[model samples]
Target: MRASDRAYATLLDEIQSGSLPPGAVLAEVEQASRLGVSRTPLREALGRLGADGLVVQQSPRVTVVADIDAGDIRELFELRRALEETAARLAAVRGDAAAFADLAGEFAAVTLGDADGLDTYYALIARFDAALDAAVANDYLIAALRTVRTHLVRVRRLARDNPQRLAASVAEHRLIASAIGARDADLAAHATHVHLHNALESVLASLGGGTTTGGAITTQGAA
Candidate 1:
């Protein structure tokens, strides 16, 4: 990769992994020198991130990462419920055999799932979910999925670490896959929503008194 691309990726990875945290300021000149890239390409990379809502640049003043809190997570999930349901429904209706195969491929991966530790299951799901997003064939729906995908990344790890949740999640996706395979729009949407709803409740309970960020395990929400 080019120097600027490398710098951009490194910075983005740091931010997403929570190392850089949020609202961290970055300057073009400093980062270019640090990443061993010229200002022009670094600026281009930053511009891309800015469009992705990962960065905010204000002229010559400063650039900083956008930060979202627990409240933001709640909002993000709410949007996910709406947008993802619509996407699932569309996938069920419009998804061809190729889409079914794609969903099935992801469904197969869950059988190898490990509940004890973090795995790339979440990333795999993202790819599966992306298929549905594309199947929606609607720009608005696709755009929303692109936006919400980032916020869901962290919560996905915590949620999947729960043993019961891992199995339940697999079952949920299977149902979604089945519905889509059957070409039943309503069923697909309903299955997806039910899965997400169950997850929200389980996760809220797992999180206890804290936000979805979950500082500790506790008994709360619903059983």
Candidate 2:
């Protein structure tokens, strides 16, 4: 990978993992040296991040990670609902029934026990997402979903493991997959909506009721 891509990937991972929490300042010189990259490449990486809405420029020489809150989460879910429900409906119409049936079986078999277990569950979800994308076969729709997923990684970090939520999510995904396999467009869309609603509520509750734009923004000094 190019130096800038390397930097961007590293920084993106850090940001999503909460190592570089919301509002964290990413000084050009400091990050460049830390990542062993020169200023030019670091700047390029920051520019890309800014474009992704993961960071924002405060002034000529200042930038910081963007803030996220309950309001932002709600907006994100709104978009998610539209995209995912459409994807599910399309998948129900165009997807391979046998493939989706297999996926539903996998979801039924998932058991989130430890960290490794949760990782496995997430990997399964990724597979489901990939299948949905492939089934839809619409470049524009897939692109929009990708953008939503980028922010979703960071949003997911706000919530810890709730066994009940995880279990419910598994059942919801299973139902969605089964509905698609059955070619039930209406059921697939409704299942996706219910899953998102429950997910949003769970994430907000995890944030001690809800988050705001209050503490997620910080300004850095311009050089």
Candidate 3:
């Protein structure tokens, strides 16, 4: 991989995993040395991260990880609802029913009692997302959804402590896949709406009754 690509992937993973939390300073010289890259590639990586809204440049030489609060989560969910609901409806009409049926069966058998099980469950969700993207067959919509999902990784990490919510999400995904497999567009869309609603509520509650912009949760700094 290109040095810029490598740096971007490492930084993106750190950001999503909370190894580099919000408002973390990212000094180019320090980060470049730590990542074994020169300043040029590190700057390129930071530029891409800024474009992704995962980082913000406070000055020509200062960049910090972006802050995410309850309001940001709400706004993200709003876009997620629009895109995912529409995707479900379209997939119901145009997707491969058998594939969704298989996914639904996998969701039904999901067991998240262990770390490995959780990994499997998340992999299944990834497959479901891939199937949704393929079934929709709209590049524009898929691109927009991809952007939403990028920030969603950070939000989702906040909710990982709640096994109850994760279990509920499994059931919700099953219903969505089942509805699409049955070719019921209305039901599929409605199910997606419900799932997103529940997910947003869970994430907000996990944030200690919803943090605000003025008083956001703070974590460790990143490179």
TM-score of each: 0.73, 0.92, 0.92
Model 1 RMSD, rounded to 1 decimal: 5.4
- Candidate 1 TM-score, true structure as reference: 0.73
Tens digits of per-residue lDDT, candidate 3, 81-105, equal 8999999999999999999999999
TM-score of 3: 0.92
- Model 2: lDDT of residue 167: 94
Summed over model 2, clashes come to 0
Candidate 1 ranges beyond 4 A from true positions: 1-4, 56-60, 97-109, 112-120, 154-160, 201-223
What tens-digit string does per-residue lDDT give for candidate 2 at 1-223?
9999999999999989899888888999999999999999999999999988899887787889888877777788889989999999999999998899999999998979765888889999999999999999999999999999999999899677799999999999999999999999999999998898888777877766743333241122211
- Decreasing lDDT order of the candidates: 3, 2, 1
Q: Of 1 and 2, which scores higher on lDDT?
A: 2
Model 3 lDDT, full chain set = 0.90
Q: Rank all candidate structures by their TM-score, best first, as comma-separated numbers.
A: 3, 2, 1
Models, CA RMSD each:
5.4, 5.9, 4.9
Candidate 3 or 1, higher lDDT: 3
lDDT of each: 0.70, 0.89, 0.90
Number of the top lDDT candidate: 3
